[model samples]
Target chain A: MSAATEAPLLELDGLVTEFRTGGAWHAALRGVSFALARNETLALVGESGCGKSVTALSIMGLLPPANSRIAAGRIRFAGRDLVGLSEEAMRKLRGNEISMIFQEPMTSLNPVLTVGFQVAESLRYHRGMEGQAARRAALELLDQVKIPAAAQRFDDYPHQFSGGMRQRVMIAMALACRPKLLLADEPTTALDVTIQAQVLALLAELKSAYGMAMIFITHNLGVVASIADRVAVMYAGAIVETAAVDELFARPTHPYTEALLRTIPRVDEDSAGLAAIPGQVPPLSAMPPGCRFAPRCALREAECEATDPALAPLPAAADHRVRCRVRAPATAAPRHA
Target chain B: MPEPMLEVAGLRKFFEVKRGFPRATTVTVRALDGISFTVGAGQSFGLVGESGCGKSTAGRAVLRLIEPDEGRVAFKGEDVLAAGKERLRALRRKMQIVFQDPYASLNPRRMIGKALTEPMRVHGVGAPGERVARAELLLAEVGLPKNAMTRYPHEFSGGQRQRIGIARALTLEPELIVADEPVSALDVSIQSQILLLLQGLQERRRLSFIFISHDLGVVRYFCQSMAVMYLGRIVETGPIPAIFKEPLHPYTKMLRDASPVPDPTRKVAMLRIEGEVPSAVNPPAGCHFHTRCPHAMEICRKAYPEWTPLGDGRGVACHLHKV
Candidate 1:
């Protein structure tokens, strides 16, 4: 691969995104960093208010302008830092080089406009395609997302579509430009299980066909297991663990990850009883001083409460990194040594 | 076995919705079409289905919160639908429901203590002082601190509010509780906490629960037996283990295959059926699932299949299983 191809398609270096609450800025994303390669799917797994959605908003430059801003760090997409880019410059990249789909398609889509017109708007805006060309492209995109009878339903409004069909329309709109990167935030969370399976399958097929890198943000571990190539488990505004999907599921290093895995009731196996983590995710404004998870972590140490732990790579596998004082110590010797 | 705690026979609920333009037509939405199930004393029976499949409707109908249009609901062999106003009011003390959204179910302005004690007060179960004591005890039982009683609903987190909801349900010492998606709104860690709490309450109180949920994993863990509904009809009904291991109805099989398991090795099954669930108002003729069933036959489209008993509390309503 050439150097350009070898480089990560998107990289976040110590990204800190903050939102102003009660007249004081509180960090929603605290020193979060990750790299996404071409055509790879990275799942951002976390509970609600864990800053997964905030991370996607940060990348898309969709964060609220009045109260929220990138406090520090860089968000580099294809060798360009998105943080300092002008709105005009960012607008050109958005929906062309990168696109996003939200959880509630009903809220995301324009109610008054026809589904076809909404989809074609993206093509006309990004690619400057007009008239017949844009319409044809939009129809094809709808068909690609497997919206049945795309031509017949093209003129139908958003309300005409069901929950699953509306989500298909949202996917159609996001994939219209064949963007290099796609940010899907709980795209199938609103749909039924059967519909969710179809959507997940469609996303997987479309990702490979388009060869697009994707950041899939969801709280569903089952979804993360199915769709993600690599997984970044977040908690209290930080990435607690990141590793290959198989390795992460097999050997979850972080205490939070381990506890979360045990908590989910599996359909495949008859779980005796789920082990519930006692404390909830701390509020962002009242975050703990040291390790954010130390208060709820089972393997907490005296030092854990005194100092925050850096995300350090495990000796067993360099790619499998974890943020913990006790588990993955910074001075741990490499396995090869 | 001892007489079942709750027996529902041909329970039906239909809603007439007005649609169209100037020449409007009354459409009959068959939310619960002749669904029947029994919950033995202290047994957890789950009603599982996708959205609009009528699981929630079934839960509501059994409690008579929404009066059913037809069929019989018997509590301990007592005809619930036929009960007089005073008789029904007494019966209400034994039957209660916990809604899905804890925030919406609770009154934001009312203190948690008031919410918990009000049901007891209405039923005239205890004196004012005793009701307050019981409210605090219930709060402690649900794992909430005593201080939580004085706080408003908004003061607590989603999980804490759910605990309050559960505590409120227990204020009347109901024998059968219709927990409609109680843990669905909670986070994974918090979901487990709530599940364990419910499980503990079930064991200690020996309460029977009619658990309603869309998540197969949650249903499997919480329910001993379950009925998989599709467009207001039970497609498959049996022990959770049997049905999960060998699903008879194609709809049940699809639901089982479609549910994403936490394990990465087991790839989510490619759903053979396509298209969203048909509208309940105008469900397809014959088997409602025929429109999506991969193995759908001419007979399936012409007439609904009869329930086929498989012995040992197992049954299926599908042409494929009709022997």
Candidate 2:
């Protein structure tokens, strides 16, 4: 339980990210907060438009051109607040101390640049190692990622590499500086199952070897189960539930989380006819006044519609937190389950 | 067993590629080297594989959407590949296809009613009034409200649009519907809704399906039996339970190992299959998967392994499974 007492490597408290859409500023991520310990894997799992990516973009300070910005919250990284940092200061931190990887490797990697040059360019820019030093380091990084015949394929273009191999190059570039924190946004979404496994295995191995903390954002729960030490289930722009990976799956505290875990069919087990959560995520503009998930919640009470429930720790578990009216509140008996 | 509902044997399709503009040498992509399978009537058969594995191509080749260079596609003992344009059109009414992308498949310019009714009108199924009635019934069957008939595709969400696509596929009352990655684009919550809906429809209509998808979980749930395709060949084919429990082919076993169970106690192990799938344009000699296979033998690179049938209606194409 040393992790319980130790200071988190990255702590986001009450992160409220806003996006300017249709002449209005809407909060896409409403008060998302989580802590990542050193060498920990925190999986941010949710469906599209659930603010999983927005949280990453906000953390990375790579929000889109429009007025998308973090309106509130403190992003403390190693005792330093990143929210108020200048672009120049943030730029220095990025790709050196904090690295990020996107889902689409084909689009993320420069098509015109050679794989070796792309990997080496980071080493040169971030580490100031030029010429042969950068090239040799790049080759070593590629080999570390287990790309077959890394020496021979140095000059190969992005188009020449397969989807899986191109992703390996992306990983090599991200790991070139050995950042303390890695923000991977659905890194293996576009890959085949086998290729995704290979990438994930490589990522896990690298994460442990480098002793880096990660905020892995993905929509797939199965992938989260495999790699994540902790899981944060988000819905409609807020963290609905957070728990240790095994405990959360064993006893899901939030109704949304419960529905979500039961919804998808698993390859390993026979499916009990899938249970749907019914309606879609509410639009940002038409966000309801009270509990955001009330309309879709099965155990919706009159009180649930009038007052918003703050995320609180579950009664039995100190670490597990949930933002649901039923099945979580210490005062409220478990009604839904 | 009465010639099966559909039988595809030794289906082959090739694509030509040219590199340079002036003096480009034409390269041949043997997309479907030779794949064969059978789908019983009222049964769902899965075509599982990763991207560029030719599962989609095989699905289309069976319906002659992309005419194969060789092999036979028989539907209910009728030669589908040999059918003329008129016969093909008639055959198409019996074997419709549900596309992977629901949003792109439907015409935005037309109303949902028009899109659903057009299929019935093309086949001259009934009078104009009856076709409209049938279209509404399809909407109801696919879990969409009747008011959905007048709305355009953009009005509905991805899941609703997919339901509309399923409705459109069901319009002609087709016997066999080819659902190509139907739920891949949907959210996990909605994916099961569609899968359940599809299963209900399958039971009620007795629709035989050629279910093609990359997600093995969805395939395992929806399909009774499946054929695992790799570089355009069925590496393993068997009942879903047996295949899931004990896969014979190295590629098939790797695929199973690669799929992560939604349980944190189960961590995905190190990959046994290495390297990316080779380009289909010039597949390797002998076993196409030898480049990545962990158990590749000396003979694997020289000669293609013969298909070994293990008497339980299950089989694999691998040197290790030689019988």
Candidate 3:
């Protein structure tokens, strides 16, 4: 309940998550570390199969049962290590201390139950409110999300709501507990452009109003550029770069990040064709050595194929950092110091 | 100027849904209500709209993929709707389709090599070795590695599989390709790559395209002309700049406003349209978007607005532009 200045709202220190597939273990998150400051919006930007969602799930302790395991690293929440917490302990944190909104609202929300009931169900379970109290609270949350006629639509099921409205309900449900941190995984992907904009703005407003630290995971640079305070570029199960939004966009250090920015269709510049990364993000099981992006990187060199790059700050900036074999060495020591 | 490759006039496809059982209540969905447009010999025409607005259905109806209940479709001056099965089959050589979901559209069991050559074989355009050579050329043309020929749909990433889909669609060497949300399923970075590939193929093959999508940004980049659909009908049709800069239709304005401005500093007031899309089976009586239009007039609620041209090849179906 204390201010997050003592420790981050959420911090993953050298987190490693793996899965057993094809009779062998596959590393989904390899020595990943990051922190979500209070009221900050950190975007995890990556293409499909880059483990952004997996990282989010790992933070929420919602990994699938198959062969999923957080092999190493500490997840500190309010200065307490949550990595080895029991299932009951973790469940207590979910929705009360932290909450998450999934990508597709249609699938995430209960179809048969009334949306009010579904939203209220979280309140009843977490805050121990029942029946009328829960319903009133749910209506209040919906009104807070600016859903018109919230009280009148309390009995209407999820199918009765539009895509955008359903997403609002989802956001309302996620924020019902007033959690300190919120994780949104591609919440606008399924909605139309207009609806997507509304949801993004609503999330921004809610984050500010609640003073919540938000981890927004999305593949759209446009979305990231709009809402993210800081951007984390991920490729093939690794954080390639992390920087303040303006710095990341203005001067991308890693070639992968640079190529990604180039590949985006800009309304300003006139280009013959997009600068493609040339190859797909390699399969997690068959990750390339040295640099995970070397095969697809345009600025690859001989040394890139021999060793992995450690994420470290650039010479000029204190916070901006990039992971690249050519640009960043394994150790932080200066080359000529 | 070269002759138009495709022309559509007053195209209408209505679906009558029978619901409830006492005597059977009926409702008519005006999916594509009297929409008209044309694509030049090698120009890309984009049709964009939210889901259930009937953009996909319109594309399918244009190609005679689905039998339209009304209106005219002409491909190279031949009436597509009136054409017989044999004529339509022959016309298939001039047109092909690439679907939005690459994995769903492509046969997962078949290898990429086979999928690329199957279309060419169906058209009986080349010999086995010739088909293989053409397939390899297409794979390379889409910027796929040579080794990708034998890979199955599951083996390739979403981007690579989309490239393979493009290669397959290009194998027939059709003059026009109806791409239905082709890049909507991929990442933003990969989407640009696919868009660039599509643009390149358009230039080299001199291919015309009917690109259908919901993203206005991508459409603006790829489409030479634009058409905005609402609840199953075209509300606005014009050049890209005209539509983006000065959208005449209320729905088009909302779409523009809704698009997330890449810059956080510039706050664009989203013209939020109230109410959900009316049931397709039982759409509103007049002006399909009237129920949700912010500037809906009384006439819009009672009578269907007439589609009028605003000159210079721009037209909007709205009462505000009745003049």
Candidate 4:
């Protein structure tokens, strides 16, 4: 649990993003921060509207320039500050050094264009390959993603492929440039369970083979357990806890993390009953005065309502951090540790 | 032994798809090809499958919401498929259904009270004066606030709206409720709450449920018995705990194994079975799953496997248990 001296492949420090709605600016991401090492997968998990996708979009520079702004923060990728990077610079880095795959590939992809052409476009633009050279690379990319009859299907349009195959094409495009970091936002959620397993396994294999670090965003905890090296639990626009996949599941420090774990019905074994969190996520526009999760948290006390809690590292395990005053006491170290 | 509240036999529903647009040849897509299972008086039966596996179709077909080409659906030993319009309409009140999407199921513009009372008004269950009081009572029964009746569907969260849907189902006092992926759309916390509410309602009302879902965990917890469908056929049907402990069919085993267990350290044996489901229009000649089964043999491709019973209502359709 000691601090890692080595530099991470990507890091975000005190990132705050706001959106202008109805002429009023509202903060959607409040002081969100995390880091990912090369070849390591950090699963960003949260409920709907928890800013999981927004964080990914913020990093991709896909957020609306007119309404949303990164008010304060540092986004350092490979030791380079990327907060205020010019659009042209970001374009050069995006898809070449970093690529993103969304939840529904069918919608994300251009329907008219052949998937092969779409996948090859990244190669031609990023690596400057031409004609046959690009086509060959695209076919190889398709093969790597395990698309059956890759060569034969190259000329087929997006509609010709199925949901699972379309996702593979999306992955082929994302990995075309061999990006150092891949931001996958619920990439497997739309597929069937068996197909989801296939995609997750493919992603795991691809990550290792290419030595690509990834920020895998998903709402399913079971997906996080197998696919992630570590996990960052986000709630109400900020991370409530960050721990190794095993530790977070084993001993969740934050009340929200604990409740989230208890809510999942078990397939591996019998569960007495699911313990649901009492209330809904507070509306973002009219948030509570103190801890964002205080209203729903069973462990919430008077002091928790009076002051907002900041994410703090537990002394016994420097890597395990929790943003909870009542549930995680600073003085008392983790009992198991 | 107590007679099951609902019974289905050799149910089939097929849709015709036109391939190659201009010179299109119509092909039969066998959505629900002769699948059958039962639910006890107050026990839940889960129907689990992927997108095109026909679980939803089966639910709709059993309820007579969708007319099936062939099948025998018996509720309380009465023929459902052969029932006349008046009889079928009367039977509908006894067998209701809850849809998956809470938002889409409810009328957004109408108040929740009116939405709940409309069924009773059509069935002529109660006096006009009693419908309003009944709506409020049903709302509270599903654990929603009394004021929920006056609010529109948009005002409620996904979880609350689901509760409203459940309440609407209860308004008819149906003996069996077909809940199609009822909790799949909500957050995990909200999903549990709905599951618990259903569990409590089942205990209190002695209501049987046809629980349909892609999520094995939720189904395993909610349904006492289950049927795993593959390519429109029930590959396996048995008690949920028994199936979970030891899956007999390769397809069911693959589904169980593929389900992501929340435990990080539990590494399930990775089966080599691959490929998405083939089009149902022209399903593999014999066993529909033979194309993707890890232990598929030559005989599997040559002939369709017969349903083999393993006693205690546990059965499977596969060549592996041909003895």
Off by over 4 Å in 3: A1-6, A267-273, A325-337, B18-26, B127-133, B143-151, B267-279, B282-286, B290-303
lDDT of 4: 0.90
Residue B262, candidate 1: how far off, in angstroms?
Answer: 1.3
Better of 3 and 4 by TM-score: 4
User: If ranked by TM-score, best first, what sequence of candidates would result?
Assistant: 1, 4, 2, 3
lDDT of 4 by residue, A1-337 (tens): 2325678889888889998888887878998888888889999999998889889988888899988999989889987888889999999989999999989999989999998999999888979999999999999999999999999999999989999999999999999999999999999888888888889989999999999999999999998988999999999899989999988888889999889888988888888778989888887788898899999989889989888887877766777889888866656453221
**Candidate 3's iRMSD:** 2.8
Q: Provide the clashing-pair count of each candidate structure.
A: 0, 0, 1, 0
Q: Fraction of true contacts kept, per model?
A: 0.72, 0.81, 0.41, 0.61
RMSD of 1: 2.1
> Alpha carbon lDDT of residue B225, candidate 3?
89
Quick one: best lDDT, which candidate?
1
- lDDT (Cα, tens digit) per residue for candidate 3, span A120-217: 87799889999889888999999999888898998898887888899899999999999988999999988887678778878888899999999999
Report the error of model 1 at residue A150, Å.
1.4
Best by TM-score: 1
Q: Which digits, one per residue and each the tens of the lDDT, describe model 2 over residues B67-115?
A: 9999999999999999999999999999989998988999898999999
Better of 1 and 3 by lDDT: 1
TM of chain B, each: 0.97, 0.97, 0.94, 0.97
**DockQ, model 4, C-alpha based:** 0.67
Local distance difference test, per candidate? 0.91, 0.89, 0.84, 0.90
Docking quality (DockQ) for each candidate: 0.78, 0.76, 0.47, 0.67
Better of 3 and 4 by DockQ: 4
Cα lDDT of model 1 overall?
A: 0.91
**TM-score of candidate 1 to 2 decimals:** 0.98
